[model samples]
Target chain A: EAGVTQSPRYAVLQEGQAVSFWCDPISGHDTLYWYQQPRDQGPQLLVYFRDEAVIDNSQLPSDRFSAVRPKGTNSTLKIQSAKQGDTATYLCASSFPGLGGHTNTGQLYFGEGSKLTVL
Target chain B: AQSVTQPDARVTVSEGASLQLRCKYSSSVTPYLFWYVQYPRQGLQLLLKYYSGDPVVQGVNGFEAEFSKSNSSFHLRKASVHWSDSAVYFCAVSIDNNRIFFGDGTQLVVKP
Candidate 1:
């Protein structure tokens, strides 16, 4: 099976510029996620969707970051007015909805990630 | 609220040596725990996971993790390390059917 796919593996932008990253999850996966991984840090959850409905985005930087999964298969995460601190790898992941409606217990499949650098 | 912690920032060991990476988590209830490995310029790959029963869980590439409820710990281990096994490892936690919380990560360097 093909794994999750992400476009623009590497991106470089200047401060105050904006960029959008795209993700195509594995077929039939109902849960799609976006994470930010700063250098030397683990992936931090930014947002997630379940069949086009956002499940959680409390950790997302609302002022500068936004994500959407319109068709529930592909997703886009956009960061507006990027800052130097926004330089980090943006990772996308997907998981089949857990059995018995337990979404918290499933294993996740991840993409190679899009590295964003804001200078 | 859920969070994970990996105390070791980096660890170095000779090839064929045994390996252990520590992880701790904070959660109100029983949370699902997972270990993932990320090689250079690659995405995180699941090494193993523990939900319940049998504190020790086996994973891909001869990796395993033992869950300790008392200490709120889930540490990854390998019987023998290979140079190819060198990578950054993360411990993650999740609760209430929500998003996963990740650790700061631990970088492992295996010397040949």
Candidate 2:
């Protein structure tokens, strides 16, 4: 089975510039997640969607970050007016809801990630 | 407050040595716990997961995790680690279904 795919494995932008990262989740997966991982740190949740409908975006920076899953298959994460602090790897993951036997343990499949650097 | 904590930022051990990576989570209720390994230039992969029952869960690559509700811990262990096991390991917690939170991660260095 083909895993989740993400484009632009790396991105470099100057402060105040903007960039967009794209993701195509695995087939038949309903839940998609976007996470930001700084250097030497674990990934932090930014936003998530369930079949084109956002489940939770509380952690997303409303002012600068935005994400959309239009067709419920592909997703796009855009950052406006990027700052140096925005330098981190953007990871995209997907999972089928109520998965992993009868327990629903929710195991995610991740992409290699798109590393973004804002200088 | 940090939901999940991996106190050890890095650990080094000789190849074929036993290995243990510590993980602790803060929650009133028992949540689903998972351990993920990130290899060089690769995405994070599931090593194992913990739900109810057994307390000890087996994972890929001869890895396993022991869940302790009283201690609020889920620590990953291996009988003997290979040099290929050198990577960053993360402990994660999932609550309210799929809402997940992750730890800072521990870097394991297995020297030959």
Candidate 3:
């Protein structure tokens, strides 16, 4: 089975520029997430969606970052007026909710991630 | 709110030596724990997970994690280190299935 897919693998941009990252999750997966991983750090959740409804996005930067999953299968994360601090890897992950018993410890599948550099 | 802590920023060990990476969590109830590894330029992969049942859970590549509810910890260990095992390891916790909180990560270096 194919895993989560994301693109472009890398992106370089200047300050104030805008960029978008896309993600295609595994088939039948109901939960999709976007995370930002700074160098030498673990991924920080930006937003997540269950089906077409957003479950949580409190950590997301409302001014510059936005995400949407229109069809509940594919998602896009867009950054407006990117800054140098935005330089990090954007990771996309998916999971089957409530698959692992009551605790729902199901594994998450991630994509290769898009490395963004804002100069 | 649930959170994960990986105190070590980096660790180095000779090949064939034993390895252990520490993780601690803060939660009100019994939490779901996971260990994930990220190789260079690759996505994070599941090493193992612990929800219930046995405290010790085995994962791929000889990696194992022991979950302690009393101590609020889920530490990863391996009997012997391999050069290929060098990667960043993250500990994550979740009270519910919707959100997961990850640690700062620990980078492991296995010397030849």
Report the number of the highest-TM-score candidate: 1
Please provide, for model 3 over A1-119, each residue's C-alpha lDDT reduced to its tens digit, 9 standing for 90 to 100: 99999999999999999999999999988889999999888899999988898989999999999999999999999999999999999999998857453333458899999999999
TM-score of each: 0.97, 0.96, 0.95
Model 2 stretches astray by more than 4 angstroms:
A99-104
Q: lDDT tens digits, residues A1-119, model 2? A: 99999989999999999999999999988889999999999999999998899988999999999999998999999999999999999999998867442223468999999999998
Error of 2 at B107 (Å): 0.4
TM-score of 3: 0.95
Error of 3 at B94 (Å): 0.6
DockQ of 2: 0.69
Prediction 2: B-chain TM-score: 0.96
- Candidate 3 structure quality by residue, lDDT tens digits, B1-112: 8899999999999999999999999998988899999998788999998889999999999999998888999999999999999999999988885688899999999999
Listing every candidate in turn, what is its Cα RMSD in Å to the true structure after a full C-alpha superposition?
1.1, 1.8, 1.6
Q: For residues B1-112, what per-residue lDDT tens digits would candidate 2 score against the true structure? A: 3389999999999999999999999986888899999999999999999878999999999999999988989999999999999999999998665778899999999999
TM-score values for chain B across all models: 0.97, 0.96, 0.98
Instruction: Output the better candidate (1/2) by TM-score.
Output: 1
